[model samples]
Target: MNDQPLSGLTVIDFSTLLPGPLATLMLAEAGATVIKIERPGGEDMRFFPPKSGDVGTLYAMLNRGKRCLELDLKAADARARILELTDAADIVVEQFRPGVMARLGLGADELCARNPRLIHCSITGFGQSGPRAMEAGHDLNYMALTGLLALSRGSFDAPVLPPAQFADIGGGSFPAVINILLALLQRDRTGKGSRLDIAMCDAMFTFALFAQAQLTTLGHAPKNGADLLTGASPRYRLYPAADGHLIAVGALEDKFWQALCDAVELPDLHRDDRRDSEACAAAMAERIASRTAAEWVPVLAGADCCATPLATLEDAFRDPHFLERGLFDFTADADDTPIPATIVPIDRAFRGRAGAIDPD
Candidate 1:
C-alpha cells in the first residue's frame, strides 16, 4: 500500500496536454490511483516537439505513476467502459469542448447520478455555458482574451508565447485539481457530488489580481512594462548582461529597496522616491550591461535584495536551493531510460508555506 496522503483515492483522467496531465500527476505523486485514458492513437502530447530521438520527454514526465489505456472515446464501447471506470472513481477530469461530454451521455449530471460521491471536473477554453464555449483556443488565445498577455508583452513588434502555460495548465488544470479536492472534503459532510466547470479564459482573468486592484483603486490600468511591478520602477525590472544574459530585480519593499541601493553603492537612491526613475533605470541598465552573468550573480546573492541572474531551463535544474529542497526527481522508464521529473514541493513541515495542502 502507498503511504501518501491520497493513497486510496482513484482518479479517472480523460484530459490531454500539459494542464490536465500535470494536475493528475500531482495527485499521482500523492499516491492516488490515476488512470490516464488516452485516445486510440496515443496521448496528444506524445507528438509534441523536442522528442528524445523518438520519445516525448514531456509526455513521459507528466504521465509518470499512471497507467495509460487506449480507447476510442467516440465509440459506444468506449463510453460504456468510461462510465464503468468513472463509477468507481473518486474524481473525473475531462478537458474537452463543453457539449462533447453531454453528447456522449457522460455529462456531470449523468455521472453524478451514477456515482453520488464523485467529483466531476470539466476544463475547457471557455465555460460550459458561455457564448464562446465552442470556439477553440490555446494558452495564448486565452491570455489575449483576458488581457494577461500584456503582463509579459515585450518591446519587439512581434508577439511571443509566454514561457509558462499560464492559461491551460495554470488556470484550467490546477484550478480543477484544487476544486475537486475541495469537493471531496465537502462530500464528507454533504454526502453528495458536484460538477466544476473550469474555463481557461475565465481563469486567465484571476491572474491580474494586483493589476485589477490597481485599476479599481487608481482608476487607470498601466500598460506593458509601464506599471510599477511591471518594470516602470528601477527596482523591479530585468537588466541585460554584457554577455546577453539577464538579471531580474525586484527590490520592492522599502527595506529591500534600501538594501539593493546599498549593495549597488547608490545609497542616494533611497532618498528619491520620485527621482527621475527613467534616468535611474537607464543608468542601472547600463551598469548591469557592463558585466557578464558570472560576475554579478554572487554580488546579488550576497545582497539579499531580491535580484538574481536569470538562468536557462537546463541550467536552472542545477540551482542549489531547488536541489536541496528536492524540487527535481529522477525516474526510470519501462526501458530503464532516465526520466527527470519535477517533484511537488509538499513536505512534512509545509504548514508554514502559504499554499501548502492541508493534512487531514
Candidate 2:
C-alpha cells in the first residue's frame, strides 16, 4: 500500500447517493483519504431499506472506505469546519445544483483559491451554464434528455427502465474520476488547481455514438429494437429457450454468424440475414426455442459463435472466470460481518490493502 497511486492525497466529498459516492469510493480504494461530509442526520441513503445490521447495504458498499463527518453546512460552525478542511484537501467533490455551493460561500473558486493545488470536481445533471442546469433531474431524466433512452426501448405502450444507472455511473461518476485524475496531473506540472464540470447528460451522448453515426449518414433515426446492435439482426439478440431461460447471441461477424446458422440448422434463405432480417430472426428464434438453454450450451460452447445462456445475478456471482480473477477479494464490513465489497474497475496494482478504511 506504500506505493498506492493516491497515497498522499485527501478528498473532501460533499456529495451523496450513487454517482458522487461511487466516484469517491474509487478514490478511497486508490488510497486517497476521503472524508465524506454529510448532514446532521446523515445522507438519506444511510436510511435506505435492505439494511445489513444498522447500515444500508448500498450505503455501506458505496462508502466502504471513506470516513464520515456529520455537518450541517448551513450552520456557521459547519461552514468554518469545511473551509478548514478545504485549505488542506487535495480534491473536493460536490453534487449540488448550480449556485448552491457559491451561495454557501464554499464554491470551487473559493475552495481552490484556498488550496492552490486542489482538484475541484462538480457533478450535476446538466452543465453549470446550460438552460437545464438548475432543473431537477435524475439518472432516467438525464438519459431521456440525451436520446439514449429512445435507442433501446420496450413495447409501444410502455418503455423499459434501464437495468442499471448508466447515466449516473458511466456519465457522471466515470467522467468526474477521469477528469479529477487528469487535473491532478495538470496540477503537478502547472502548480495550480482546476475545476471540472461533469454534467451527467453531457456524457450520455457518447453512449449513442453508433446511433448518432447512423442518423448523420442516413438522415434517419433508427427505430427502437430495430437497429443492428439493438435487436434487429439474428446475430445479436436474446432468444427464449424451452425452459423459459434466455440465450444471448452475439454472432456479429460473418464467421460467427455462419457458425450460429450451422448450429441452428437455419434454412439457406435465412442464412443471408441481410437479405431478409425479419425472416432470418424468426427462423433463428424457432430453432433456439426448441431446446433448453442447458441443452444448447455445449453445442454452442465449442462453436465459437458467441452464443450463450443469459445468466441471472446469482449465476454471475458464482461465475468461475470472475472468481479466478480475484474480483471479490476485497471485503466490506456490515456490522462486523465481512461481505464482498463492491467490485471496482481499478487494477490490483493501484489499489490499497483490503478493508483499508475504518468502518466505524
Candidate 3:
C-alpha cells in the first residue's frame, strides 16, 4: 500500500515551464498520480539549453515522476479528452491567462460543473479580473511590479534581477499547492470542490510584509536595500572573504551577534551603534577580509555563530546535509544516465520515496 498522504489521488496538470509544473511536482512527490498534458510539440521548457539529449535539464528535474501526454486543447477531441480526465481527477492545475481556459471551454466553471469534487487551480501572472490580468510577464516582471525587486535594488541605478524565480516559485507554485491542499480539506467538509484563482503578483504581497511593517509603524517607506533585512544592518548582511568568496552572516539575535563578533575578533561590533550601520559594516568587512571563506567556516562553527559560506550551485547540490538526507536521489536523464532529481520540501515521514518514478 502507498502510505503517502496524497496516495490514491489523481492530479491533471496543464502547467508548463516552472510554476504549475513545480506545484504538481510536489503533489506527485507526495504520491499523487500526476498526468501532465503537454502541447503538440511539448512545452517550451523542453528546448531550454543544457539538454541531456533532447530534454532540457531543467525540464527533467522539475517534471520527474509525472506521466506525459500530448494534447492540442484547441481541438474538440482534445477538450473531450480533458473533460474525461477531469471526471477522474481530484485536482486540476493550469497556468494560462484568465480567459484562455474559458475560450477553450476548460475553465473552472465548465470543468467543475462536470466534476463537483474537482479542485480547479488557475495560476496566472495577475489574476482573472484585473487591469494587468492580460499583461505579458515572466518572473522578473512579476518581481518588478511587486516591489520586491525595488527592495533588492539597494539604491542602485537599475533594478537587479534576483538569481531565483521568487515570484514564479514562491508566489505561484507554493501558494497554488497550499490553496489546493486547503481546498481539498474543505471538500471533505462541504463535499464540494472550489476554484482557486492564484495571482502570482498578488501572492508577492506576503513577502513584502516586513517592508510594509516599516512603512506602517515608522510612517517611512523602506528605500531600496535600506531595510533591516535588506543588507542595511551590519548584523544581517553578506561579507566578502579574503579569497573573493562571500559569507552570509545572519547574526540577527544578540547572542548570535556576540558570537559572530567574538569569532571575527571584533568585539566592538557587539555594541549598539544605533544609526551607523555603514561604519559597523565597514569594520565587519575589514575583519572578515582578513581570512578566506574556507578558513572561516570552522572558526564560525567553533563560535556557534549563524554564519556560513555562500555556496555555489554545484557545491549546494553536494552539501553534506542534503546528501545525508538523500535529497539528491535521481532517476535517469534523457541519455539514460542518472541525474539528480529535485526533492519536495516535505518531511521524510510523509514522503513517498527518494527517487523519481520512470515516466510510463
Model 2 regions more than 4 Å off: 354-360
| Tens-digit lDDT string for candidate 3 (110-171) | 99999999999999999888899999999888988987778877445655568888899999
**List of clashing residue pairs for candidate 3:** none
Worst 10 residues of 1 by lDDT: 351-360
- The candidate that wins on TM-score is 2
Local lDDT at 317 for model 3: 83
Off by over 4 Å in 3: 154-159, 267-270, 353-360
Ordered by TM-score, highest first, the candidates read 2, 3, 1
lDDT of 1 by residue, 118-223 (tens): 9988888888886898999989899988878886687778756688888977797678778978888899899888888888888777888777887899997778
Q: Which 10-residue window of candidate 2 scores lowest in summed lDDT?
A: 351-360
* Candidate 2, 126-155: lDDT as tens digits: 988868999999999999888888989799
After superposition, candidate 1 runs with Cα above 4 Å error: 267-273, 332-335, 348-360
lDDT (Cα atoms) of all candidates against the true structure:
0.77, 0.89, 0.85
